[model samples]
Target: MKKHTFMLALTIVLSVVLGACSSNNSNNGAAIETNLTAKEMVDQMLSKVEQPSLMELDAATVEQLYHLNPELLEDYSIRMPMMNVKTNEIAVLKVKDVKDMTTVEDAIKARATDVQKQFETYLPDQYENAKNYKLIKKGNYFLFVIADPADQDKLVADFDTYFTEK
Candidate 1:
């Protein structure tokens, strides 16, 4: 009886030791390292020719302008969260000095229209979906979102118009 008990205890200790050793070996067997930064990622993405155009718009009384002329948004569609899958780049427009606008919603509408027009001109091909515009207002800034590269050339061509008209 004594001998049998000793054997059982020895077997249990050996099994526990072997299990721990195997687990440790597996944990150390593989390792991976990556070197990436936010700026670097942006640069790399911009370097690609197929990337979409991004722009920022600066304007005064942006909110008032939209309220005065909402029709200017004839060529834009609201952007949705799921649209990220189809977009290769994003353009942000910052509007300045909108003292005339009474509300944030008006400013957003105006800014979105302006940005959408610019995007439409810059990337006519990419805007084929006819519903690729997003208008977002944060504090005093309005954000215009554009996705797709099919209209990149049109976007470039329309660049000059953005400055001349606005």
Candidate 2:
């Protein structure tokens, strides 16, 4: 009877240990699978857009390009003047990829001030609410930046700087 009881207690302890180990392994697997880099997310978003056309325009001309429709401008989170004129619509630039700097929290951390200044200089009018812009890091490879509708031109230009292939 003593040997049988010892065996039963050992079996219970072993089962508990096995269960805990399996749970930990599963959690680790999940973390690995969900670990996405920033660049990957940006690439994914860009891939979904119809081919983007590059165009340069002064700040004032942006409203005219989009037909001066405030409603249209308000419809999207980030509106670029590079539009599908046939449909009178702006292509949505989603967060498709994010690459975090090894040491920085923001994707454009080091370049943030420079980037902001560049936008302000090139597109002053749009920069009125530049502080409100949203920079979302979807993964390690993609950094999704949301531009205000009024800042479409500046945003488009900024976006081109990152998304355009070398």
Candidate 3:
């Protein structure tokens, strides 16, 4: 009877310890710290793809178009298709604080929804790209990409490498 009680207590202790360790690792965002600036990171990722006439966007233009203010970001890079008819865009942002993540994410989703609406009627392929875009977050950084579906996964995998390699 005493042996059974001892084993139960040990099992409970181990469970608590393991649970706490896993929680800490996840909450710490896996301690992702990259030496590259946001612009450099995005530029490198874009270089891997067969880009299609993308134009870099200034902060004011981003604010006007996406309703996401540059002031809230620690660093960022944005590129949109040169032609309004093309629905391809890439936005990579590092928020100054984790608390601002929801705000930034919400704005990006809204921008995606708006873009989908704009293209859904006139341009089928562009509309599909906008509808099936990838929006992902890692640590304090967020990446929102609307491009060829085949390229989206590669871009996300490349982004993960930045975190993992560090």
Candidate 4:
């Protein structure tokens, strides 16, 4: 009787453990790591809510915005950065190393400062959105979003789900 009980408990434990693991190879699967690209994750986020107008920055635009040496972050990929000037904005960036990570972090901060200045000068309406923006750094990726922060947790989780690579 004791052996039977032990066997049943072991079976249950094994089932539970197996159930927690991921079995899919696709990016959307419930895997241990994210299979989706940064752009894919951003698109997923956009699908979840009303997306704001964000202009994807080009080489010139990015260069003007950063206004620093070009070689430092040449390998950095800023995915589909879009901003509506006053309404809302979002930036998804992936870099090669920790040093570039700091540069990206600083860039976000500087952008926030720029937004603040805009608010002070001509667009007080952007204050509410800017005050509680979401900034997330997971692995080598950096995400900055300015929107209704009510869904911030969900947004972060959505991005985080794909952090681990297959």
Candidates ranked by lDDT: 3, 4, 1, 2
lDDT of 4 at 155: 72
Taking the tens digit of each residue's C-alpha lDDT, what string does model 1 give over 119-158?
4655555444324544333322233334443444343333
RMSD of 2: 16.9
- Candidate 2's TM-score reads 0.31
Displacement of the residue 7 alpha carbon in candidate 3, Å:
30
Supply candidate 1's per-residue lDDT for 64: 46
Q: lDDT of all the models against the reference?
A: 0.39, 0.36, 0.86, 0.63
TM-score of each: 0.26, 0.31, 0.81, 0.65
Off by over 4 Å in 4: 1-33, 68-85
Model 1 scores what on Cα lDDT?
A: 0.39
What residue runs in model 2 are displaced by over 4 Å at the alpha carbon?
1-40, 49-102, 125-130, 138-142, 149-166
- The TM-score that candidate 1 achieves is 0.26
Q: Which tens-of-lDDT digit does each residue in 1-166 have in candidate 4?
A: 9999999999999988776643322334432345666567777877786655555556676667655333554233343335445546665666555467677778777776666666665666567667777878665567777666766566777777666644
Q: Which ten-residue region of model 2 has the weakest summed lDDT?
A: 84-93
Winning candidate number (lDDT) = 3
